[model samples]
Target: MKKILYAIIPILAFSIIFLNMFFGHLVFESETQEVINKYSVYVHLLSEWQSESKNIIFDVTNTWYKSDKIRNTNHVFDAESKEYNSNQLHEINGKSYVELKHEFSDCQEEWQPMLYRKAVDTVRHEIEYVQGQQLSTDPSVSVYPDTENENYDNSEQQSKIKNGFVQFFPICTSKDTTSYNFSVKTDNKDLGFDVYFVSSSDQRENFVNSKFDYYTESGCYGQNKQSYSGTCHDIKKDSGLLVIFPDDLKPWTTKVTVNLYENN
Candidate 1:
């Protein structure tokens, strides 16, 4: 009987261990699924723009790879006010993310801008849209309406406060010419920046196919447009980099010159 009792103890302990392992796995799988679902839209965007130049900008702007602490912090739903936490959504990947905290003031408090320079640089590469454009105006501009419309009423103001951050995220990072310029090369009338073939007209059809085929091969996402001349043009290449903001984070354009240096 004593031998039987000893055997039963071991069996009970083994059963408990097995149950814990099974339940642990189930919990882990559930959380992973939640996190993945929350990022479904972003993942789709990433997959679509992975190869385009806009992808480079957006990827740099909204980076997911970061320190565990920042990534682990709950940036989604806000339980306190029973609403979404828009502040946490601004962490655009590790490449271009902003950190904003409310400032204290004796009379009236305000939200100061904490511009992330790295994020600005990420957008710089895509500023190749217009070449030789000067930033005559302030890079970041924000404008607000003087009075609210009757239709909006008080609810509109409250709604704006809650959903305001969503508007700011895109505004703060979109088309930012703070430290750089963005312009297309309009100076070159006849010959503009365009994709061409490495082969003659006879093989041009294959060349066109080859270009698009290469984009797909390189894991680029999006549709390729075929020009009247039968050449494929990547339209979505840098569209994502051309985001516009309302009044806040004002728009600015800069000019760049690629000129030859004359040595004395």
Candidate 2:
């Protein structure tokens, strides 16, 4: 009897030790995996934020170029005299070209600092929230504002038209077909204008020269109104141009707002 009891005691002790070690390893592995998944999510969020910041900077730079072009075309200055043509500098909301340029420069200077601060705040908040909650490994699950699901892209530009015509080129970032909504509102709603979306400069010239009887027949999307709101989906290239001219061939000034949305 004594011999049998000693053998059973040893077996029971071994079994207890083995069971404890096995369960401890499983718990440890689960914790490690959880941490890894959380880290992956954090990294993904940071990458996405960085990409968005780059896009913002790119858009701002492009806008600056476009605005500069419009200013040069409308506000012609005598090279020798260093004098701006008073007739060409039309004021909108009492803001002249100089004032607008100054404001734009200020905005450009602040963008980087604002973006950096936002990135830091967003990451810190996310880290705290993640530590208290079970986060999914899916990269799409993010606390930051989802620009894709919301406003894909938006831009506003003000142009003073002295030649009775102006053209704006907007970039299409998406590889696939996307729809762009344009809202052209002017201070003078009674002053009607013509807006055309053409794929090429030749097409624009043809339209401007009245080569076609109808805009649709000319293979261009167009609107004739004092203020227009419409969508254009024929932008198949990396960029598209919007040509605007007053209906009465008179000088006009207006503000244009463009909103880009992608199809699901």
Candidate with the greatest TM-score versus the true structure: 2
Residue pairs with colliding backbones in model 2 are none
Off by over 4 Å in 2: 1-163, 209-222, 238-241, 247-254, 258-264
Q: Each model's C-alpha lDDT?
A: 0.22, 0.32
Best model per lDDT: 2
Q: Candidate 1 — worst ten consecutive residues by lDDT sum?
A: 33-42
TM-score: model 1 vs. ground truth = 0.16
Backbone clashes, each candidate? 22, 0
Give the lDDT of residue 176 in candidate 2.
40
lDDT of 2 by residue, 167-245 (tens): 4344333244444444332333333344555554454345434552322423234443443444556455443445453
